[model samples]
Target: MGLALFELPAVSYEGNLKEITDQLVILVLDDGRTFNFKRSTNTKFFKNSKALKAAELKPGDRVALVAKLDDRAFLVASTVTFVEMTAERSAEIAAGVRRAQETADAASPVRGWDGPQLKRRALDEPGPIPDPRAGQSPSDDPLIAKAQDAALSFSEALPNFLCEERMQRFSRDSRMIGWKPLDTISAEVIYEDGRESYRNLKINDRPTNKKMEELSGSWSTGEFNTTLRNLFHPASAAVFQSAEYSRLLDLPARVYDFEVRQENSHWNIQVDFQKITPGYKGSVWIEPASGRVLRMEMQAVDLPPEFPMDQVETAVDYAFLPIGAAAVLLPVHAENLGCQRGTDYCNRNVIDFRNYRKYVSDSTVKFDP
Candidate 1:
């Protein structure tokens, strides 16, 4: 067979502006993927069939962007067009407005990179250290008992509940500087009787097809819910190390970093962080007064020679979301990122729990209607 070549088509997503940070424009596309794009002077912007500015693009606006992977390996928008009706017209903007494009000469790039980067600010920076305690033990620390009690109380109080789960995975841009959207998974996660279940609801905003394995939640389920309930359970085998002070959700907290190592096996499901190092290392953040776990961070330690992954970092942020009429501390967001050694390859899972409801029943059935 003879090999023929064709121009690779560009990637684009149509969605509403979900968020605008220092350097990145996050779009929640109707297709389910939350596309992250870097805006540069070469990036064009428009509004109402006229050339506007990027700053003029607000959340909730209907827009379309024609983007291409840039030399830096980032998704850069070549043109951004806004669709809007005349102030009084009830009709949609004319089709011609979709062609408007303007060069943004004033937008500034925050990171040293030439464009917007996806590195989450809150996740990367471990904020300043609180109340230096270089050599202190939990024996005499009053906060320890209080925080421990809070964690236990929180776990014991955990009720059967359900929430909307949106998980997006990112893989390192093969030729770019950072990661790009690899797949988006939306599911419903429910926890009851110490058991968790995730129902794959949609993939890329489309119904799940059993034939497509990547869209299935089976691979990413089970890890977070159990880890949530067991991490601070006084009986866990993981050992705590340094105790320091930190803040989560803008509230004071006592942080305890710990490690969990495997005895003699390699990691099975996901990359085993403990295999390379002594164990998996992470920290727990507990609210000082009320004693509830607010946040947790974990990273694989001591990667071994020839290990497939170079680094692994994961974080989960907790908030008291409503379930029926009761409010309970639950995982609102969780992310897992695995980086390959000696390559730009990276894999990240971004999970969000929302729309919580009380667990009504555990029975489920499926059939063709």
Candidate 2:
């Protein structure tokens, strides 16, 4: 029999670009698999039918590529195309904008982080409180050291637990009017082996198969301890300033304002399919007596003008609640707010955590509206 040659057919792949190099591109698929596709001189690149230079490629861009096996059995890209928003994605964005308008016309609670009154209070009243550490650097303050220790302990000592999370999503126009009730979302949050995940989701009292992070409109996770860990983690190299004595929820607190540089920031913002990391500044309220973090707030800083979001901020309040047979400190409430760039559209979410219990391997979860 004569020797025969076989050639594999070209395959198509679609994913978000994670890295782009001169010779190859790394893409992370929606299913979390990472693939590397070699680029050759014969490969063509395009966006909206327009030719693009290799240098123009950026990470986080959605791309579709066709690749064929080379003589060496390596997958080599023959054509790369940048994907624009699909009809479904465009419709979702439009619905979010429409909801922002509808919220302006509806009646609901006036509570929002962006309200003028709250803005003024945030900017003015929180002024430096007279304290013994007024003249010292925040790093030298004993209170900060104690708070950092407490945060580290919380991260390490927390046991695996499950909790019910209730989130009320709202939207409002730029007029700073009252917020309107949009929908209520309920999910089972699992903290296992120092990781957090969500399941058993219910939107507006209706069950859904979608993950909490995959939901349309605004949603957030990691309120349990992620932010606290990031803020107080020694490796984050956050800059702190202006330690002040204050009260949070009637408990004596040591307040410190801190900023995390973009190089060291773990805060990731995702809009549609694009992702960006922006530096953030925030305030942490720590109970002086126990060094526990009572509350924490953050606001994104120096966001790219081209980014879709104009402003992003969050505040979380922590409290000690009985979980199983022990009293555990966990997030009791959280507020997340974001506004569209150059538009009146904004989304706000108020989240509450309750019904905490120790997580077991065989525990079954039922959705509770």
**What TM-score goes with each of the models?**
0.55, 0.69
TM-score of 1: 0.55
Clash list (residue pairs), candidate 1? 73-176, 276-302, 277-302
> What is the clash count for each candidate, in the order shown?
3, 0
Candidate 2's residue-wise lDDT over 181-299, tens digit each? 89999988899988899888888888899987678888887788778888888877888775577666666777778999876888877775445667889888788778898888898
The alpha-carbon lDDT assigned to residue 158 of candidate 1 equals: 67
**lDDT for position 174 in model 1:** 54
RMSD to truth, every model:
22.1, 13.0
Whole-model alpha-carbon lDDT for candidate 1: 0.60
lDDT on C-alpha atoms for all candidate structures: 0.60, 0.77
- lDDT, residue 69, model 2: 87
Specify the poorest-scoring 10-residue window by lDDT in model 2: 116-125
Q: Which regions of candidate 1 deviate over 4 angstroms? A: 1-134, 139-142, 149-155, 173-176, 209-219, 222-224, 233-244, 264-278, 304-306, 362-369
lDDT of 1 at 53: 72
